[model samples]
Target: MSGIYIHIPFCKQACHYCNFHFSTSLRLKDEMINAICKEITLRKNYLANNILNSIYFGGGTPSLMNADDLSKIFETINKYFQWSPESEITLEANPDDVDNKKLKIFKTYGINRLSIGIQSFFDADLKWMNRAHNSKEALDSIKVAQGEGFSNISIDLIYGSPTTSDDMWKKNIELALESDVPHISSYCLTVEEKTALFHQIQHKKTTAPDLERANIQFDALIKSLTSAGFDHYEISNFAKKHHIAIHNTNYWKGQSYLGIGPSAHSYNGQSRSWNVANNKKYIDSINKEILPIETEFLTPSIRYNEYIMTGLRTMWGVNSDEISVLGDMYRVHFLSNIVKEIDSGLVHICDDQYVLTERGKYFADRIAMNLFFVN
Candidate 1:
């Protein structure tokens, strides 16, 4: 099954640590929406006509879009592509954008899932991140959505920020559990280049994130969520059984997907492409009936490395047998290199498949890097 992703590139304000492509200005919002619809028609074959199992409205803050705007985009998708009745339609919303009124609009537009960006439940952490919503709004929105009958919900949480104490972090987790949402995506705060957080750390205006604290919180998240009966299906994601995000899981399984809009990426199994990051440029090109994007075909080594990187991050570990599908040499090399890790208890053999141990998960990036196909 394939998926479609539409990026809405406008946000109310920039977060201190966000490097995502978005404009705080809505000057080009209408034009961008029109262009994205046109792009969907122009690139309808990107997923090779696979039935769409998921349609994700992600971005600067998709919840900012009105019902009519969302419906117009959905109409374009329905017209140009095959759709499944059971398809999961998700919208990423900021806490400030979610209210009873907006949630009703979302239901009317066929948005079956809500991925709320509730970074933290504390006002201090919200201020530190520059999130537009306050603590009350954060708590209120989720309850509002639930009150409006939206059961399929996911919330994002941020940990490891300077303002986040372990006590406060536990409260955030407790808040999520109390909200009774079935899914969560938790991330650690990181300083990315060109972000305000980066500049602040570089100028010593704020201290850099403490890796130790981050690790501690991550461990806390796992323990707490697991105790709450959440499945650790993938790194950074926890869900109740049958509530895993189909779109992200399809991505991890290397399924094809079409992405429409500026800065959106599309993959059709063998190659990947991304639209131009400039909003105006993308709008102009699509208005002229052109797909403004760049693409790269994957080499075997690149694909192999990707498999290891993504595979090991999931509960489903990297399979040595799957490497043989690439070629015998890849399988041989991976098995030989992973032997040491297996012996060290960083990885374990489960039913003939190699999966990362819980301890190994903390070092997932380092382990994946070591296993990269460097040739």
Candidate 2:
């Protein structure tokens, strides 16, 4: 099953920790949309299969777009590709952008899933993150979407912020559970370089996220959500039965996908490509009927490492049979290195799959790196 990801590079305000490519001004919104449609037409045959199982509208904030903008894009998509009624269609939204009228418009456009950004349900945490929406809006957005009949919904929450104490973090999870969202994606606050949070940390204006505190909160998140009948499907994602995110699950499972718009990335098993991140350059190049993309063909070692990295972070785990297909040497290397992890109680073997233990999830990246087949 293949998927399509559309990046909308416009936002109303900048979050302190965001490093995504976007513009606060909507000056080029129309041109950007036109370029996106044209690019979709140009790359119509990029994916081998014309049938899409999922279509995700990710970004700077897809909810910022109106009905007309979405209509034009959907029209182009329908003109080229095919999807059944069961196809998962998701849109990333900010709480402030969701209202009764906007939700109705989104529903009219065939958006079945909503991934709302509700980082925290506290005014102080929202202020710290420089989020545009307040606590009330964050809570109300989900209710409003539910009221509008969006049952397959997900909400994002951030833990490990300095302003969020252990109690506050627990409260955030409790509030999210009370909202009855089928899925929740919670991430630890990281200070990426070039983001305002990084600058603040560098200048000693704010404290960096405490690793110990973050781990504690992660454990709490797992315990609370699991007790409430949510599956820890992915390290940072939890969902009730049959509610896992198909689009993101496809990505982790290394399925093919096509990406539309500037700064989007695509993968087709053998290679990966990403479009030029600059909005103006992307628009100009698309206007000239050129794809502003850079491609990289993956080597066996790189593919092996990538699989190990992504596979270990999920509940499904990594299959030894799949590793053996990469090459005999890769299988040997993985088996030899993974013994220590299993012996140390960080990983376990179950029916020819290597799955991370509860202790290992905290060090998933490091463990994956240890098992990497570096060239």
Candidate 3:
């Protein structure tokens, strides 16, 4: 099965640490929606399978769009692709943008899942991140969404922020547990280049995230969440039984998906492509019936490395049999490289699947790099 990701490139305000393609202005909202629908039609045949297991509305903040905007896009998608009652339709929302009316509207559009961007539960942390929502809104949003019957909800939380003390971080996790969402995606604060947070750190205006502190918090997060019956399914994701994110899990499992809108990426098993990051350029191209995308065909070596990179970051781990399908040389390279990791207790084999140990989780990327099939 395949999936589609629709990018809504508009936000009410910019977060301090975000570098994703987005416009804070709503000047081109109507035009952008038209362009997105057009692009959806233009790339109808991109996914080999016409049946979609999932459709994700990601952002900038999908909740910023009105019901009419969502309806238009949904109509366009329905005209081109097919999804059933069991299919997962997700919308990424901000706390401030959520209300009973909006929640009902989203439910009417068949959005079975809501991934709320609740980065922190403290007012200080919210201000530090320049998020559009405050601490109270964060909790209220979850309560309201739950009240509206959005059981398959996930919340994004950021740890290791300069403004979040250990106590605050613990409180955040505790509050999240109390809120009782089925899935949680958490990440450590990283200052990406060209972001306000990076500039602040470079100018010594604010402190950078402390790695040691982050490590401790990560341990706390794992202990707290796992104890609460959440599976650490992916490196950055935890889910209750049967509640894993189908769209994102498909990505980790090397499934093909089509991404629409500015700065969106698509992979179709053999190659990868991404749309132009500029909203105006994307709209202009789609208006002219042209796809503003760059494509890169994946070499066997590249594909193998990608599998290794993504596979290791999940509970599914890398499969020896799958590696053999790439080529004998790749299998040889993997076998040779993995021995050292296995010997070091960083990885272990269970029925030929090289799964990471708890300690290895800390060095997931590094381990993947070490095991790469260098040409």
lDDT of each: 0.90, 0.95, 0.95
Off by over 4 Å in 1: none
Clashes of 1: 0
Overall local distance difference test of candidate 2: 0.95
Model 2 misses residue 266 by how many Å? 0.3
What lDDT score goes with residue 309 in model 3? Answer: 97
Q: Among all windows of ten consecutive residues in candidate 3, which has the lowest summed lDDT?
A: 366-375
Q: For candidate 3, lDDT tens digit of each residue in 221-251?
A: 9999999999998889999999999999999
Lowest summed-lDDT stretch of 10 residues in model 1?
Answer: 78-87
User: What is candidate 1's CA lDDT for residue 357?
Assistant: 89
Q: For candidate 3, report its TM-score.
A: 0.99
TM-score of each: 0.98, 0.99, 0.99
> What are the RMSDs of all candidates, in order?
0.9, 0.7, 0.6
Candidate 1, clashing residue pairs? Answer: none
Candidate scoring better on TM-score of 1 and 3: 3
